[model samples]
Target chain A: MISALQSVPFESVLAGGLLIGFAALLLFAFNGRIAGVCGITFSLIKHHPTLPSMTWRWLFLGGLVAGTLLYHFLTNTPFPEPPNNSLPLLIGGGLLVGYGTSMGSGCTSGHGVCGIARFSTRSITATACFMAAGIVSLFVFKHLFGWSI
Target chain B: MNQKIIALLAGLLFGAGLAASGMNDSNVVQGFLDVSGDWNPSLMFVMAAALMVTIPGFQYFLRRKPIFAQGFQLPSLKSIDRQLVIGAIIFGAGWGLVGLCPGPAIAALGYLNWEGVVFVLAMLAGAKLRQVQTT
Candidate 1:
């Protein structure tokens, strides 16, 4: 019901994207790690590494939290409003996302942003699949189920 | 210690990007997924811009060894498999259902929203379930 031309937030999107790229670049340049949250989370949970090894991951995540807070304070970006969906939907959605990212080995940042930049065929394929599936899922949920999420 | 500091700063920049791009908002994401409805193509611009910087920077920076690391850590596989496809399918469904990916989810929590808390807890549980084995 809407054209993308009107809805696209150009300035913010561009600025934000640059920042994301910078973040990914710095992470790889310095720590040699992909800024993949799911991957990092898995390592934190499953990798029984020593304290020295574990510290960086925790710091990275902590910085994420801090940066978010700083952005809010500096820019006064309003916090996101919660979706008006059923609890079952929320729970199921969260579970699937967590599992899929783990199984797939990356999410948007790793596969979508960083992977595409690297020109990896696997990342390209995975990103395409993620987008296609999301579109189809949204269509089904809205048209067939008549649910407003 | 220096590695930890840089990592944290990297996380901060990433979070800033997510926030600035309005990705922390579930509605914006849902809008993007809603191709049949109110679609927003801002995500495309975000992707392009990110690639513009990273494609050159990441590829170029690697000519030299990383300052803190011996070498650049990157994924090597170029093959497609069932795990990748199935995982993407499930992830896409969940994203469409709630419009919260891993990065944005964490950013939302930075705002201290209780809704984010619930989703994160469920996500954590889902992740931990991987340790379970079925015989």
Candidate 2:
């Protein structure tokens, strides 16, 4: 049983979920932001110089950075090293996501968590696309491209 | 004073949760994506855990009226049209190639992962490209 837990990578998942939920709760409680990555990112870009909700955006973004820093401090855990990947692939992937987020009107957080929770049809549609794209992409890369990152 | 402020606090806690749960780790996420290689079911567990909390949290919120805005703004669209299909295909492709998505990818920044930086830059670019095309 102990060995099973060790092999399962339980700590990371628990920590991740807790932080995500806490962030959602905080956003709802203090800023009422929904913690949707797509919306936040979009707003940052769409209304750049004249940030309409600058304070909340800053605070929300700040909390994201601060929460992680605090967790590391409290747990005394060393941060994990970044995964290895080519620069091109990394850049390309980001571009694709950016495009998708705009087209879909939200990313996983907006659609997956906030959207789904709110039972937003648009979010459901968007999230479905997000997940489907993820699954299909994995298949192509692994089988067709024979690429493993 | 505003609901946006409340949202920011929620986002912070959510980011913290991601860190705490270790979902920010690409390797772990990669493990889930990698069906052939040492399948890691930990992602499922993390998701389940999140759902457990979220389900109740949402229910509680539903019972009460929106404290800030008019009401809970749910997505109204129902059709799984062309945009939905195409977008999903693209998103899945990206996720498959790289085990980073918007949520976990951003959360990864807390760990100071360079890849997170790269992913975010690309993600922003992707978002911008779409905006330009649409406009």
Candidate 3:
């Protein structure tokens, strides 16, 4: 396994970080929406017709893919291929991520980025829990089970 | 009308940033999660830089009303309850295991990977499961 710490992708990551920040800022300034992917996607999919039309949600999601492609086109750099191929693992992980985000009322974008920006107490607490859980889970998976998926 | 275009632009920028930041890499994300292993601190820098920009940017836009919308859809709940903690724990565990949170998972679709497609479909199904508990 390559050590990410040693060969850190410093430049691209920072560039991406600024872009992410700018995106969140734009959404806030323009739409008054939390740039939380889970929230945005779910609201578009799981809501009733009486609610506001999901026109923007679809466009935003579409733009997400378009933007990446545009980046590839302009920079002549493409995203790497998917590493994981396990069906069960993907399904289980997806279910957990979805259910948990719904239950917790947020995901990485909502809590990690936007929440931290607002300094919201709940976001702070939620962020701490999730990060701790990720660490503990990784420790157990790596050390105890000796599994790497 | 304008909001839709802005929303699309935001999404595009977000997707590009996600890819650029290496958040779309499951292995990289899991490495960042591993506290005892070969930990990657790149995510920390990303968040710090993001917040550095967002915090000040948020304040700057505080006075100005939304151009075409009403106001910011900021979270209002102040208290951290059981749901938040337990849900976060579950989410974190899932994230550590697969490193496919919603943003990256959805964006990964652009890569045309089977895993991304499968993950997104299953995530949508999982999102639907939420209604089962309620209804």
Candidate 4:
């Protein structure tokens, strides 16, 4: 476990967190919006009645793709190979994520970061539930069944 | 126009953060989840640091009206209902299986792979199905 810690790059992780926080700050300060990716995606597909406009969602998502490409370009970091999981696994997981986030009303970025920051009880509970579920499921699927995900 | 530009910039930063933090990699996330095995504490640090900044920033920002919009748009629902818990658990199971959520899945598109494309499409389809059910 300690050896695993050694491989975990602290510098990049810290930088990434700061960047994410700052990004959320920018959105909240300037645009009065939470930088929740799942919510943003869902709103794009189905317009929310209360929101002002849809263009920002497209631009924000576009920026996500562009930002990733920019990181690889500037840092010359090679993209990790796609997991060896089967197509069905990928589709099934994706479907659950989409449906669950929509039903639950947020994902990690929404509830974990933005909602938690605001001291929202619902977000807090959701975060705990997801974290617990993730741990248990990983324990069952990966450790017990030896599934490589 | 300025709001859109800011949104774009914020997204770029957010995406870069996701890439830099190694959250874009499913294996890294899985490692974090695999506590009984070789546990990785990176995700904890990322969320901790993010909350440090976000909590302060939001506190300050909430005091004033937003520059672009008429007001700050926050979640109004506070109920800890069954749907929220059940949805989160189901989502968590999926996350455990794949180690890719909506954010990372979208960012993974930078790799320009079919898997990312397929996952994203399936995600959208699932969300649509959920919407249909709710409505």
Candidate 5:
């Protein structure tokens, strides 16, 4: 863990934070959207493929992949080794994330970033709940069940 | 056209930021969540710094209409309801298990890794389940 932190320079993290904020600002200022990834993903599912409104969603998501590609191209950094979780574990985790975000109406970016920025009580509460839940889950999974990361 | 362009650019920047900050790495996120172990505080720093920019930026933007859209399309639901808590708990648990939240998961697809593909498909299925239940 310490090694991971040490591996990614502090400047990169800070710069990334600023870039994220700037990105949020760009979306809000121009499109009046919250820049919530889960919400966008949900909408992509809900709307018909040919819907005009779906255009932006598709573009944004495409951009997400492209941006990562750009990063790799620019830095020549190799992808991190994918975790060795079982198929069942991965499927279960994905299911929880998808369903929970839908029910909760947001995820980390929606609730943790945009919502918190707006100082919404709901966002704050949601963020707290998830953070606590993550902590508990990690402790139980790794410490008790002995799941390796 | 302009709106679409901005959305694409924003998404691009967002993805780049996630990649740069090491948020796309499951190990880093898992390390952060491992409170009872050798906890990594990088995520905290990311959130704090992000808040520093967003708090003020959102405040300024909220005061006026957006440049392209007629009005801000903000979430109207304000109540701290049970659904929100339960859903967040479930999401967090999943996040802890995989250390791959929505944004990072999407960004990681650039690697063309099979894990990212599998997780995303499963996530979509989960979301489909929610849709079925509601509708």
Candidate 6:
């Protein structure tokens, strides 16, 4: 088992801390949004009639892409390599996630971050379900199905 | 300051977390998702660290009267229905198969991982399809 403090990249951890802090600062300073993905996506879908909300969603998502690109260009981090998996599996998995997100009413970001942070009872339940599913899937795929990338 | 701005900021922080934690690394994520292989527990540490930062913020918010908004919105429903079970199963299958969830999948852009690209595209497609199905 990996000890909590032993394996972490300290520099990376600090960077992560700073980044989250920055986000909190931005949210407080600017639009006051909670940076929840599911809620944003849900708002976009459910409140399509509201152009302002829709516009914000697009802008927020754009910022996400822009931020990653900015970091990559600045630091010259190597790109992530492709997983050695079949396209069919990829497509299938994506479909499942879409379906799951709809059924669950939010994605990990919505529930895992904003939901849990606010101590939303619903988020707690959703996060628990998300983690449990992830753990169980790993067991089934690796042990029972004997699947490999 | 509105919720949109706050969300934008939160996303940036969350993205940075995903990147720094090596959660964006396909290999590390795959390791976590792979039980048959050299399973990595670093992901758990990342979660703990995130909680360390977030839990305090949460408590702080609780003490105050919504510094950033009129009031904090909390979800009301708490029943486990068929939708919940089915959704969990599907989500687990996807995570097991792809080793990339939505947050880190987008963050993987920093690494320019092809799998990440594929996963994000598929995830978007999934989201679109879900919209259609619901409507």
Task: State candidate 3's TM-score.
Answer: 0.93
Ranking by lDDT: 4, 5, 3, 1, 2, 6
Candidate 4 chain A — worst ten consecutive residues by lDDT sum? A1-10
TM-score of each: 0.93, 0.84, 0.93, 0.95, 0.97, 0.80
DockQ of each: 0.71, 0.52, 0.71, 0.77, 0.80, 0.43
DockQ for the candidate 2 complex? 0.52
Q: What tens digits encode model 4's per-residue C-alpha lDDT throughout B21-109? A: 88888888888888999888778988988888999988888888888889998888888999999999989988888888899899999
What shift in Å separates residue A72 of candidate 5 from its native position after superposition?
1.7
Interface RMSD to the true structure, each candidate? 1.7, 3.2, 1.7, 1.4, 1.1, 3.6
lDDT of 2 by residue, A80-109 (tens): 657656888888777777776666666766
Model 5: per-residue lDDT, tens digit, A124-143? 99999999998998899889
Give the CA lDDT, 0 to 100, for residue B84 in model 4.
Answer: 96
Between candidates 3 and 4, name the one with more favorable DockQ: 4
Error of 2 at A31 (Å): 5.1
In the range A1-149, model 1's lDDT, one tens digit per residue, is 65432353679889999999999989888888888877776667663556777788888777777887788789876666775567888888889888888777788999988887777887888889888888888889976798977
DockQ of candidate 6 against the true complex? 0.43
Model 5, stretches more than 4 Å misplaced? A4-6, A47-50
Off by over 4 Å in 2: A1-8, A29-32, A47-50, B1-5, B68-78
Candidate 3 colliding pairs: none
* Candidate 6 local lDDT, A33-77, one digit each (tens): 555654555456452457755766666666666666665566676
- Across all candidates, what is each one's fraction of true contacts kept? 0.76, 0.58, 0.73, 0.77, 0.78, 0.39
Which candidate number has the best TM-score?
Answer: 5
Alpha carbon lDDT of each predicted model? 0.81, 0.66, 0.82, 0.88, 0.87, 0.63
Point out where model 4 deviates above 4 Å.
A2-8, A47-52
